[model samples]
Target: MSRIVLRHQEKRMIWSASSNYNLQPFKIELEQNVPRMLQQVKETDLLGTFHLAGPDAGITLEQLQSLRSQWLSDFDWNKDQAILNKFHHFTAKIETLAIHFIHEKSDRPDAIPLILNHGWPGSFLEFVPVINDLTQAAKASTGQDVSFDVVVPSLPGFAFSSAPPLNWTIDDTARIFNTLMTKVLGYSEYAVHGTDWGSGVAYSLYDNFNTSVRATHLTMAPFLPATPVQLAEMNITLSAEEQFEEDEAMNWNAQGNGYFIEQTTKPNTLGLALYDNPVGSDPRAGTPPSVIDHNEILKEVSLYVLTKSFLTSIYIYWQNPNGFKSSYTKAHTDAPLLFSAFKYNIAFWPAALLQKVGNLVYYRNHDFGGHFAGLDNPPALISDLREIVVYWK
Candidate 1:
């Protein structure tokens, strides 16, 4: 049986020959790779519950031990793998890297082209439910056959996308995605939605190539002004939601920033370690796991292990240590901007932030959902997106 291969060389050509990027393609070869039960917990010293805030902020040494035991003994990997592969997957070479993405096309004639970007600790899987629900809505609402020709690309160094050979920043990523939309997919104008790191990419597109992007939506807004007049003009009022976001950002900065620091400074070292033992230990070792909540260790490991896409994902952080900083300095876009603030996200201040940024034609502070809104509440997310697109249209 011949195996399917996605091309990457063509995309890499867009970069100048002087660019120092390098990529190597490798296939996963498994022999009797099946999920097995984790070993029983042996570390008894670390057992008990740990809290992210309030009086019970830190976990006892014993709780860490117990958490490790449970993580090692429980959690199924094979189940996770089956769930991840449900969507149609394909890869394209962008420059010197292989880019993996999920393309779900709606049969509707007037389907709008939209690119959805996911952030760190998130794969293309994050947008699956949103895509499914929105596509269905398009079929029902606009009998005119309105649908979204969706493209969910794995960020370079995550999932199926190839890693960068040298340090590439968010601008580099935006350029590559722009090519993907204009050259590879052949879309003249498209809508873009992004969350977390994705928001940075979406903002870049709007700033650099506003003509190509019809509209842009972001789940996280990280821009802030240096003056008060700019804030007042933007109608920057601190609602309860906005206050909460500020508080959370402060808290995370104080107690839960080790991961970010590590990723920004020594991503390569950590990436190699994670690649070797994607599911070896509890990812919640030093801090309270809830604060930095992620899927179980087994699930995270499964994502990297089965796909062998660990290095690819890590390379994004490794190459673009200053990506976030660079994104902050980029000019604001005059295009229509939509901001969605999840209830539990403390780092978001929708009303005030949007007012200060630019023309926030649409803004919603969702009463539910969190950082991973698409995954946590797909139905609400889909409805919000549909309504916003309709209003803009």
Candidate 2:
């Protein structure tokens, strides 16, 4: 017999004090570093903004004062934490790390499990609107049994979840999440919803475990762009819709992708720079107040700053620089794929491209939403998600 050597390791799981496997009471403990962060933000001298170069054109001195004033006077972390605690929160030890997730189940027994994953510059808060809608949709007296058991997790190295092992990649994240659903929480099948980095994870779930991952709802396609030869081989042509998306993608690649390049190549450098600074912004000014609630942005900044994982969160970029574009391009899965092409999204795959990607069962061209579909337009997102159940069987 040939010699067989197998290296094995053991893991211990520490769970919350819930016995029902579905209900748990948890609280988010804010770190004591908020004061120091506040001090830094308060002491920000636009003395530099005057002599600042073009790249430093972030929030203006006036905007900085606004954020500072709000941070001091209006922002309340406890109240927001309580709001998050309204949903059932739990932690599962996947390996040596603790995975933090909000598991909100529909009251009805037949409710389907749907996992929501957030991306960069976003937190679990992105899906709160959708979660609230889905949780309440079935309970109303409307005689509709349409809802989901939503699971929103803090991606490894973000807000609540601990930093993944330094060498971990998105494939590892997908595998661990599979174990979380099946082995830990006891679900054999589930659907996934994601945006940005989370979109990559959702695709992997559907791709790697078809039996477990029944469907996927995503805002972005993680596949690499088709080569000229491949595009010619596939005889691809653009529709009016695709041309618009193409223009958006091109414009984004040209104008909005500096952060992408920096995060992928030198995350540590930029991460170190922004670790303590809460006012990080682009080379532009005057952000859209309508797209994201300023308070919501404050919450995101507070979470990143308080947890001290602002730098580690960017590790996702280093882990999957192309957001799994190379690996996913060759992937073809039986799992039903759904794409919500939000109009102002940074990049979008055309219907033709989506059809070539997976079993694209449902496609929506949302006119009002942006890159952050869940946050930008919850009603549309909720309706589309509910309709996904129609294609489930």
Candidate 3:
């Protein structure tokens, strides 16, 4: 009801100005709303969402046609909604904002408490791949502490979460989420894993609350393009794989920068057009620079459509240029940090540079997968996350 009531107020305060986080079970009436939204999609001017021709097109006339056909004939809202209900969902009001999250605890005492955050064009859904793996490992670990009690949140302004306030930044986000983990969940100390926009929040959590925020893991980091002068001075060496990844990241900046520029400068313009159509948000919204399979892409689009959270999802770009800032130049913590770079990711920073930011303990390079490693290469992300256990305790 709250989500429906707060339609598209870019600058309006959507929640009560209080910290009354009365946890409520999340339930959506997809049966009642899906048909109406689908009708809007049928009447949508999708031709505008696309502009390119030939090989490099945005969503494409063909992709748009395919999405409509799949929505009408193949998509199953009931089955998909049932799958979502399988997980534990909860929402609470925090700092005049409503926060939605998944809190699933492992039965085993050996499990450690962990929080996972998602990025823009993305929601809490990105972390679904590793949910059962992390939560169920507690049962399989038998004699050891291998699994985790996972807490994954829909970052404010995305999915079931509320659109952030007018001046809300990622650091503001970090503060509220820290409250969620420590004050709401009653966790004394915890570890965090993040990707895309999430990596910024994860880093902020590690920086602001070193005591409760124990260890940090990221698939992306603070990476900048290596200039010729800097490369020569540092004697930068890249393996063949690293060289390919560097080229891919640079190419993405050239080709994919439009989405970034529009969302950051004029998010409301696009958000308004897509407000009625849930396909307004697509699986591609959450993905990195890779060709996602049709089925995988459809599943993500369906979730946002059914939940009616797509419009608010794009608000992240407008809410915070930097998520939860923490730049005490003289301050540094020995909190163990672990990072992994997928071959096709948008950016990759050298380990030496990562050390300048925080305590660097583990780093690795994957031969396969891209930016959405959690979805594209779950096994590798799982193994990489498990790698953190070595230094966690």
Candidate 4:
């Protein structure tokens, strides 16, 4: 119940319109000898060359080098600042930390309330497209200008939210969000949706605050049992679609999971590299920049760096190492859920797996998109989410 009241000046910063969110007078103090540390990182030769992987792996090294140079020189953080400023923003003191969020209230008093959560390597930006789409759809549907009163909070240590005062877990986050819903927003009940780590938080809220939450929707469902015996016991018959997902998970775990393991056990070490000098060479020795598409890596990395969010985001991983680990074994909710799996993310889990978690009122497997469904296929995702809201009503 500790509250940090914002003065007018602080509120102005928190609620400033997007056009004004620039890093003007940009004076973010780095630790003493930061330039020295950066020099060391740059001299390490960790980022030797660029490599394009996957089907696009055929992209020439020259092309990647050109893109990297352009991003380094031409990309404007101020432009992104303007785009984000268009939304109404605010912050609240909850449990000794300043909680930053974007709150877009629907015109209709009777419209349903919803809370959207984003996962790792992403920020409030992930919800931008869906926010536009859902609000438009709701306005059109009722013909009464009704829409969702959407609240998207940057998880503590993510984006606008305050950095953690100390090590904190996802359970701590769930409690703060629950209070935000009931106390701050004055919503007695609300629907929740999440992707990635956000999915874990959404499910935890459902388990802990079943009465306060109306429905839960998720883009990623890692809690789905992996074994065939477990699947059969849940009355799920693995479809051809589900089988494909199993294969993808197996491949991702084999090839892409080293990062996850490192983050879970020694994130601070990883942070020393990512946070100290994001644009510098990778801390891991002898890794070519070509191993990762520099454009995509830079895009993701720049978002974190410019927002001053790299440390906070990494702290979330550190605080909730168990959140990631426990995601595999968490109990299912009895409440309604809308579970959608993107075809490109087929390596994760298939729609058929929803049965293992809850009474899935709606389930779908989209063939067109990937892991970042809302960003990649906003229209389709919005349509699916709208349908869920209508059906629940």
Worst 10 contiguous positions by lDDT, candidate 3: 9-18
Q: lDDT tens string, model 4, 1-393? A: 111122222235333432232212122222343334334434544346544454333335564455546555664445555666778777777768777777786554455678998877766776776785565535333233335778888888876677876667776788888877776666666788888778878878877888778788888864633565555675766668667766666665565455557777777777665521111112231232112234344445555655567656876765666664423343545678888776555246655555556667777776556565666566666766665455443
**Stretches of candidate 3 exceeding 4 Å from the true structure:** 1-20, 45-52, 138-144, 222-229, 275-292, 306-308, 322-331
Give each model's whole-structure lDDT: 0.60, 0.71, 0.70, 0.62
Give each model a TM-score: 0.72, 0.83, 0.83, 0.74
In what order do the candidates fall by lDDT, top score first?
2, 3, 4, 1
C-alpha lDDT (0 to 100) for residue 125 of candidate 4 = 73
Error of 3 at 114 (Å): 0.8
By the lDDT metric, which is better: model 1 or model 4? 4
Return whichever of 1 and 3 wins on TM-score: 3
Clashes of each: 22, 0, 5, 4
Cα-based lDDT at residue 235, candidate 3: 80
For residue 236, model 2's alpha carbon misses the true position, in angstroms, by 4.3
Candidate 1 residue-wise lDDT, 1-393, digit = tens:
111111133224424321333322233223234332232234333324543344234444544444565455655555555665666666667787677777666655456678898876667766866776565535323333345778888888776676676667777888888877776665666788887778878878877887778788887754532233444575665766556656665565566556657777776666664421211112332232122233443455555655566656666665656555412343455677777776655255545456555567777776556666666556656655664455334
Show the colliding residue pairs in model 4.
Answer: 18-85, 49-290, 50-290, 51-290
Clashes (candidate 4): 4
Q: Model 2, which residues run further than 4 Å from truth?
A: 1-25, 48-65, 138-144, 225-242, 275-291, 326-332
Number of clashing residue pairs, candidate 1: 22
Please give, for residues 1-393, the per-residue lDDT of candidate 2 as tens digits: 211111010011213212223323457877467678778777866475364435244345665567667887888877887787787787767776678898887765556678988888888877876787786554322334577878888899988788998888877888878877766666667788887888878888878888888888888877754443455577877667656666666666666677778889889887875522322222121243223655777787888888888799998888776574653353456878888887677776766677766888788886676776666777678877776676666
- TM-score attained by model 2: 0.83
